[model samples]
Target: MKLNIQQETAQDFNAVFELNKLAFGQENEPKLVELLRKSSAFIPELSLVAWFQNQIVGHILFTKIKIVNNENDTESLALAPMAVLPEFQQKGIGGQLVNSGIEEAKELGYKSIIVLGHEHYYPKFGFEPAEKWNIKSPYDVPANVFMALELTPNGLENTSGLVVYPKEFDTV
Candidate 1:
């Protein structure tokens, strides 16, 4: 497949919304995407979509988040609601979105990323338990499912704190 990964544009909003809704079989994720787009956390450069033969097949988003401790607060990135059309699920479209998103985040100077997702799937991208860095998700979820990745060397070293997500995420 000749796949293209690119930053999402204003014109792609509806298609990306529908793609998220269809991929997850629910409206929550699509709603989250819409809310994130309007929130300060949204990173336009990290909002990416995968295309094949001119049709959008997958989408991924990275947004601003913070890790706060007694001493200081650190800026970080959060990956959420990654989705691919059901027909395109196993064809590596999601993986392509993730890989491309990571590269874009690195270029944009983000140091770390947090995600609540499949334990098996994320590890391939070098995501490990967030607890390894003493980071905790605001939502109560299995430790293994809430993971983090360092975009730079020692990016997360000694960082320990509570993750603060955008208000929009609380709805989902």
Candidate 2:
């Protein structure tokens, strides 16, 4: 599918909400996206939408999250709740959004991105087990599903810690 990906705007909110709702087959992710938007964790530019045939078909959000240890609290991006309409699944739109979001993160000087998603799907984008960097997710998930990717060489070096998602995440 040919998609035109763009940074989401206020004008896109309704569509984004509906698109997420439909894609995920539930309201949690859509509601989470809405809450994140109003929180400090929100990165407007990283909230992207994919338009296919003049309609919203996909949405992806990368929000600010903290990786904390007793010694330090490092910032990283959390790639969460990425949604592509059910009908649009498996056609590379999700991958495109991920790549575009990664480039944007690098451009904005982010060091790494964390994701709790498919063990198989995310590896193609260079996401490795977060444990490789001693990074752990707050939720007890399998090592493979909770992955991390460095935006720069050794970006996650010496960055061991627990991921602390914002309070808004509890909603979903």
Candidate 3:
């Protein structure tokens, strides 16, 4: 099965939402995607859809997130709310979406990326615990689930703080 990952547009929006809903078995993710779309943190190209036969079958959103330390300077970007349609779950579409996001971030000169996700799945893309860099998430997620990847060396060097997701995420 061939898959194409592309920048999402207005026409693809509803299909992406429905894909997330089916993948997660709830309406929650669909709503979260809507909220993120309106949030100031939304990164246009980073919001991607995976297409199979031109139908959106997976969705991944990379919104601007912040890590504020004692100094209060904000270091940004954390990946979240990634989902794939139930029928597409075991395929490598999810990995392609994530890799595509990382490439976009790199080209845009983003220093680091953080993710709160399955330990096994994320590490395949080189994510290690954010704690290794003294970065943290405000919520009590498993230590293993809160992970970070430096697109450049010392991306979080000497940066210690909490990951603050955008306000849209607070709606969940």
Candidate 3 per-residue lDDT, tens place, 44-81, comes to: 98898888886888889888888887787565677878
TM-score, structure 2 vs. true: 0.98
Q: Rate the local accuracy (lDDT) of all candidates.
A: 0.93, 0.93, 0.86
Error of 3 at 152 (Å): 1.4
Candidate closest to the true structure, highest lDDT: 2
Alpha carbon lDDT of residue 77, candidate 3? 78
Model 1, span 1-172: residue lDDT tens:
5799999999999999999999889999999999999999999999998889889988999999999999999999999989999988898888888999999999999899999999999999999999998999888899999999999999998889999999999998
User: Once superposed on the true structure, which residue ranges of model 2 sit more than 4 Å away at CA?
Assistant: none
Candidate 2 structure quality by residue, lDDT tens digits, 1-172: 6789999989999998888888878999899999999999999999999999889888999999999999999999999979988888899999999999999999999999999999999999999999998899899788889999999999998899999998999887
Which runs in model 3 stand beyond 4 Å of their true positions? none
Candidate 3 TM-score, true structure as reference: 0.96
RMSD of 3: 1.1
Question: Candidate 1: where is the Cα deviation over 4 Å?
Answer: none
The residue pairs found clashing in candidate 3 are none
